[model samples]
Target: MRDAFVRALLREMARDERIVLVTGDLGFGVLRPVKEQFPDRLLNAGIAEQSMVGLAAGLAATGRKVVVYSIGNFPTLRPLEQIRNDCAYHGADVKIVCVGGGFVYGSLGMSHHATEDMAVLRAIPGVTCFTPGDPAETEAVVPAMFQTPGTCYLRLGRGNEPHAHEEPVPDWRFPKAIRLREGRDIALLSAGGILVELKRAAEKLAEAGVSAEVVSFPCLKPLDREAVLSLAGRFTDLITVEEHTILGGFGGAVCEVIAEAGCPCRVHRLGLKDEFSAVVGNQAYLRHLYGIDGEAIAEKAMALINEKRTDAGRNP
Candidate 1:
């Protein structure tokens, strides 16, 4: 996903010379192409995330489209004040990009985990949040963020994420939900890197005679309400999956839309249960431990389907 973001960013930089990239003294290998092609446009802020964001905001004020890049919490959480005050307040064209969201940096321990990024960034007014599920979605989101005229937050995974969409998304628009598979039983909505797990879960459910629809929400804030309402009308059970905490993240966002509309669809959120990850390992290992992996998602979906069946039998 990181590679895809850079590739898209490179294309955008070539098309528009107003774009500038500022890094927090990291992502050297993955961002090599950008440095080589546009050396004058790339600046390293030397690990000072707050100053880096402030600098980017200043550049944006001076008619430059500035993008601040870093891994984990450095870009978002560490310099949130600067993002809120300097960038969003002034409506600066600053795109804050955070790589290694969720447990992508699990081996480094809890400090690097970006579990609450979406929720936190979404709460700030005038800040657009993009949580692309795969490389394809990442490719689609980069250009949209640059085209947007205010502060934006982009949450990305570490490199090597499997593509959920086989081909490039056509007629892609901001905050629109992309339905990858059509099904009747339930709708499996996912944000961020967890879409791969939900896609696998849907396949597993299909083998078990349970059909599951897979939808990827590349943009979290300004969620596709029309799509959510349409799914609610068709399916009785809706599950939201995300790599971040369930509290005020993807799951919370979906629930807000459903409840306000008085939709009867039951939403079961699958994510971190309002707690930090205490264990450290690879991304897969931590997902399994937190019960947000493919196998777990499949099991939960089956249980929900059966529960509904039993309830209908008793009521009838």
Candidate 2:
């Protein structure tokens, strides 16, 4: 996903000379091509995330489309104040790009985990949040973020994430949920790179005779309310999966819409249960430990379906 973001960013930079990239002293290998092509446009802030954001905001104020690049919490949590005050407050065209959204840096430990980025960034007013689920979604989202007029937060996975969309999402618009597969039993809605696991879970559910619909939400803040409501009306069960905490993250966002609309759909959120990760290894290991992997998602979906069946039998 990081590679796809850079590729898309490169294309955008070529078209618009006003675009400048500021990094927090990382991503040298991945961003090398960017530095080589646009030598004058890239700047390194030497691990000072706050200054990086402030610089980006200043650049944006000077009529430059500035993108602050970093990994995990450095770009979001570390310099959140600068983002809120300097960028969002002034409606600066600053694109804050985070390379590792969830446990992409799990091996480094909990400090690097971006478990609450979506929720944190979404709370700030006038900040657009983009949590692309795969390289394809990342590719589609980068241009939209640049085209957007105000401050935007882009949460991306590390490189080599499996593509969820079979074909290019050429028609994808900002803040709209894309339905990857159609089903009837339940709907599996995912935000971020976990869409790959959701897709696998859908297949597993299908094998067990539970038809599951898969939807990817690339933009989280201005969530696709129409799509969420449509799914709520169509399906009795809606499961929201994210790599972040369930409390105020993707699941919380979905629940907010459903509850306010008085929708009868039962939402089962699959994510971190309001706690930080205690153990760490690789991304896959942590996902399994937290019970947000493909197998766990499949099992949870089946349990939800069975519970509904049991309830209907008892009522009838």
Candidate 3:
């Protein structure tokens, strides 16, 4: 996914001379091509995250489109004040790109985990939050952020993530939830690289005689409310899954939509609880530990399905 993001970013930079790539001395392996092609446009901020963001804001103020890239909390939580004040408050055309969201850096411990970035960034006014599900979604999101005229946040996974979309999305735009599969028993929604696990859970649910619909949410802020409401009205059970904490994350966004519309679906949010990760493990293991893994998703869906059955039996 990081490879695809860099490729798309390089493509955007090629045409737009105003676009600049600034980093906190990270992503050397993935950003090598970017540095080679646009030698003058790239800036190595050298681990100074706050200054890197502030510099991007100043550059954007001078009519340059800036993209600040770093892993996890380095470009976000570390430089939040600059982002909220310089970028978001000013409505600067600065794209804050974060790689290794959620537990992608779990082995490095909670400090490297970007579990709160989406909520933190989204809280700022005028900042767009994007969490792409796959390489194709990443490709779609970069161009959209470039065209958008204010601060934007791009939350990315590690790399080598399988393509979730079976085919290309035609005329895709930001803040629109993409429906991957359709079913009536329950609806499953996911964001970022977590979509893969949701898809797996959908298959598992199918084997267990439960039909599930899958939707991928790439854009969290300015969420596709109509899409969310459409599914909520159609399905009795709607479950939102994400790599970040359930509070104020993708699930929170979906719940807001459902609540506003008064949709009939009973919503279940699956994500990390309100605590730091204590165990050191890989991404998959961490997700399971939080009970937000693929099988966990299936279990949550089955519980909801059983509840509906029990209610019907009692009423009948």
User: RMSD in angstroms, all models?
Assistant: 0.8, 0.8, 1.1
Candidate 2 wrongly placed segments (more than 4 Å):
none
lDDT tens per residue, model 2, 101-138: 98999999999899999999999999999989999999
User: Model 3 has how many clashing residue pairs?
Assistant: 0
Which pairs clash in the backbone of model 1?
A: none
* TM-scores for every predicted model: 0.99, 0.98, 0.97
Q: After superposition, how far is residue 183 of candidate 2 from its true place, in Å?
A: 0.6
Better of 2 and 3 by TM-score: 2
Clashing pairs in 2: none
Better of 1 and 3 by lDDT: 1
After superposing candidate 1 on the true structure, give the runs of residues whose Cα lies further than 4 Å from its correct spot.
none
lDDT of each: 0.93, 0.93, 0.89
- Per-residue CA lDDT of model 3 for 174-262, tens digit only, reads 77999888898999998888888888899999999999999998898888888898998898778999888888988888888888888
Which 10-residue window of candidate 3 scores lowest in summed lDDT? Answer: 166-175
Q: What is the lDDT of residue 39 in candidate 1?
A: 97
